[model samples]
Target: MKLLFIRVSLFGILLFNGFSLKAQQVKPDDKYNRREEMITMRDGIKLHTVIFSPKGQTEKLPFLILRTPYGVNEYPSPEKQGYVKDMADDGYIFVFQDIRGRYLSEGKYAMMRFSRDKSNAKAIDEASDTYDTIDWLLKNIPDNNGRAGMYGISYDGWTTIIAALDPHPALKAVSEQATPSDMFMNDDLHHNGAFRLSYAFEYAFMEEISKTDSLYQFGNYDTYDWYLKLGPLSNMNKKYIHGKLPSWNDFTIHPNYDAYWKKQALKSRLDYPRLAIQHVSGWWDQEDMVGPQDAYKALEKKDTKNQNFIVLGPWRHGGWAGGDGRSLGNIKFEEPTATYFRKEIQAKWFAWYLKDKGDGKFAEVISFQTGSNKWKNYSAWPPKDVATKNIYFHSNGKLSFDKPSAKEAKPFDSYVSDPAKPVPYRARPIEETYGPGSRWYTWLTDDQRFVDSRPDVLTWKTDTLTQDVTITGDVIAKLYAATTGSDADWVVKLIDVYPENYKKEPKMSGYQLMIADDVFRGRFRKSFSTPEAITPNKVEVYTIDLHAADHVFKKGHKIMVQVQSTWFPIIDRNPQKYVPNIFEAKESDYQPATQKVYHSAQFASSIELPVAE
Candidate 1:
């Protein structure tokens, strides 16, 4: 966790971004004077902190702090070395801290430490530790303005958000980017009650196996094969981890959305501080996309002063924090979107609120609409005037706005979902998530045509659009599906099918771009906290949240939807058999089952789109 702060963030990504060939030539700046100190928390635990101010500073500057479970080295991190030169030039008392129990800090480490009970004075958590650190920084650090602003990416982003929940008087602004809100629901560990196999397992091993950073060595280059061959979830401990990783054990104990997860959820803390707030994320963020949006929506409800704001772009993880942002993988954007966010939005956001450098003006929501390659601003998310339109699935692999016809009774598409031969989420030879030459960063933008030929994966698409179809809000997938087994996992992907013979980019011709997607564990459909076996062969209504997006399917492009039972090792293969706890399921529980997607007038299956007015 501590290493992720520096390794999974700004500099780490910039180094790997082959797109930023131009950025690499520029020499890293090291003009700021750096000093390290051990700041004492309320519990007498000393936190590792580093402060950097301009070499020859005359005027006092507001402190911009980033608290991360990832270690902040004695010398400034690489991101501080180059990526934030703009902020450095603008003048800031930049401060970085390693949270308690992480590197250089004195205390036991905890993963995503939750908010503390305010009633208990000695109760220590990430929020309290941040408050105490700020309290100390104010008195100990010299040549600093009274005001402070907090911001970070990923884990640090989570810390930033928790700090704002119980903010201090001097904490004037917060920029929580890519922060996970609910671990068990739609972020990091699980998505709609389905375990994020590769990410969750690897992350727990990397963060918890030791105090410092560690990566679990895998034998196979294609991790999908490795995870599949590894067998049941129980083998994770018996074969390698052996009940050592805390989060892994937690995953087993709390298979359901139990009280344990409910208590620690930052989303439950809906009240936002009375300060300027900005929630930034990407539409294609493979992890934590729902987090920032969830937090932003919660803050919006209480934002009488219009302090809550959001920025949704076409990025992945910490992609927006650095790089040209002009493009990702094979997909290209209109301009250097990330650079614009940094120089225009992020820089100005803190400058205006902290230093009063600019007019206090910013959009309530800034969304980059894809396909059309344009940025749009709106007063409300899901844009208030948008109309809900349902596109139903047709028998001949077609997606139509009209309801299913009554001519055919019990109309449905059938397929055999074999656990032994699950459909790979992305192209094969998939490397370690963050390994060198890994496509994990840009997997979302990969062409979905790779799986179109698979027998088990059902593909349906609308005809070439006559005009632009702009969807600018939340998208829901209402599926009426039945299975021969008692339990299963449903994976839905909304796609944009490019017109063949596209002259602009021939290679991208016939490309199927995944716009929005998610997986839902059928057993937990009724209640996330409770599990109920499916009534086999009986159609069950499943409403899966495809999340929100702002995308445009241009004329000549087709809108497509793909439904499959398995997304490979990315999402653990649902056993298709009813078990008291999937984690403890025996090898016999795994089996192939028949899945049917109903498309009848009586039980119409469709994807709900919020077509912008």
Candidate 2:
């Protein structure tokens, strides 16, 4: 056998929460071993898997698996990453595999592979692939307990959920972090019914452009300019995509939340996971906040035995997968959240269920509430003691909890939404998604002041709060809106305005932080599947789900709301003219429109927030 050598750094890397690798070996001991194998699934196709066994383990250890479409060339080592260091110390038979058709794995890769028919004998899916791999590990690996656990972030997290659908007898625990539960509804592909262009396109270009991950080089430093120059969505095929990427093609065919999206939705197809499962999410998780939350809700319906668990922190998409979780953009979370979650929460979650080592006393829901910057534990998400309140939009740009009275002056505020110059989702010269120094991860937390003064973006704010107002649950935006065009997109944002002068953190002075926000494509106002053109210049009630959050508008700070029409690139520009398919829309289809939002008693626009008492 050929031996592989890795450079040793005698000066050890620091571990977390009082844990240290000071006594760790410069290199793995002789008893430690690594091997690569092609594990055969029930369908007879093989998947590439890499296994690592602990050095000189005293007893039998359970298997911890991570299956991913992203290349699984290297597994985490205690000497390097703090994310899995605790699990390493606990002595797991760590296994990582490239899922079907990805990297070295054999067979065709499906973007979000739908579950197979369980009644059929020859049925195969990611779940079956997992079952087959576990069967192989238990029989072939040495000194292993007959139990297994699976955990991963993002797409890997989705695969972990696949395992829970039709689990092998030995697969006893799962941890899914930042998983995309649905491609269309509230995950990566779309927010509500609006298409996510840059992400969906770039991600496909990388994932399916040749099997091994590839990157799309944007023509301009600012992708906003490149996308604008490309004109309509149809140019995507004419210029670059050109029928090669399967997912992009799928997007062109299925623009609505129709059968295609429903069939692939894991939230709808889920069965009660009988084994232990932990759902993790980040408050600012730009990618898949809807996923874990939706999955948790689906499982909650049948969780009589209490096997479901969830964690939410003030981090980005898979942000807690590494780093100290100190802060994002200009916001700081005094909580050492990522470290605590990995060391005390995620690691021990697998330990309790897989190894039976400790009492699984995890709270049903664990959340790191921002603004006040503290951690919360509850028997149920939203805590049940929460109250519902609406922050109403008032005349002359004011926000108040009190409802609008009949005596108020003007009924609404109006703005011009020009497709020619759509509002930039972030500060200008916006980098490509996943590009070097890209602020995409923390753009949601970016100071809203950039868009606050724009004529297209209208704002309403409240006076400085006299007391702490903590919001903790699903947030909904009710808009009484009118657009001059037949179609439009309504964007609503809930902001936390900082005091103008803060001596300690001078950078955050007068910061306008976004707490919860979402967009609703006007066509989907009635039904997501069957869209209808609006009667030009008529008012319509568009209710947008701003999603969930746990935040506080502390004393001396203000609560603000901003409404707008277009969020470019991130959300493909809505042509404002009704068309059968946005992907096939032409340049002539794009138009400028006057948008109005009402604050009258008859059509009071407001945000319904879940306030925790």
Candidate 1 per-residue lDDT, tens place, 1-613, comes to: 1222223432343322212212222133655777789988787889988887776789888899988765667335223443455677789988888878877888988887766777888898887888888888889878888989999878877888888888888999999888888988888888999988999987777667666556677867889888988899998888877788888998899999998898767767768557888998888888788999988888888888889999999988878866778998789996898888888888899999889999888999998888788989999986898999999998989898989989744499989999999998899988887655778888899999899789999988998899999999999999999999999999999999889988889999999999999999999989998899998999999999999989999999999999999987789989999897899988899999999999999889999999976
Instruction: Report the number of backbone clashes for model 1.
Output: 3
Each model's lDDT comes to 0.84, 0.85
Per-residue lDDT of model 2, residues 1-613, tens digit only: 1211122221121110112233333255434466789998888899999888878778999999989877655444543546677788778888889999988899999989888888987788888999999999999998999999998888888999889888999999999888888888788999888999988987887778766666577757899998888799998888776788899999999988899999999867887867888999888878888899989889988898999999988988877867778888788887778888888899889889988889879899999999888888988875688999999999999999999999878899999999899998889888877665677878889999998779999999999899999999999999998989999999999999999997768888999999999888999888889989988879899889998899999999999999999998899999999998999999999999999999999999999999987
Which residue pairs does candidate 2 place in steric collision?
none
TM-score of each: 0.95, 0.95
- Which candidate has the top score in lDDT? 2
lDDT score, candidate 1, position 93? 86
Q: Model 2, which residues run further than 4 Å from truth?
A: 1-32, 76-79
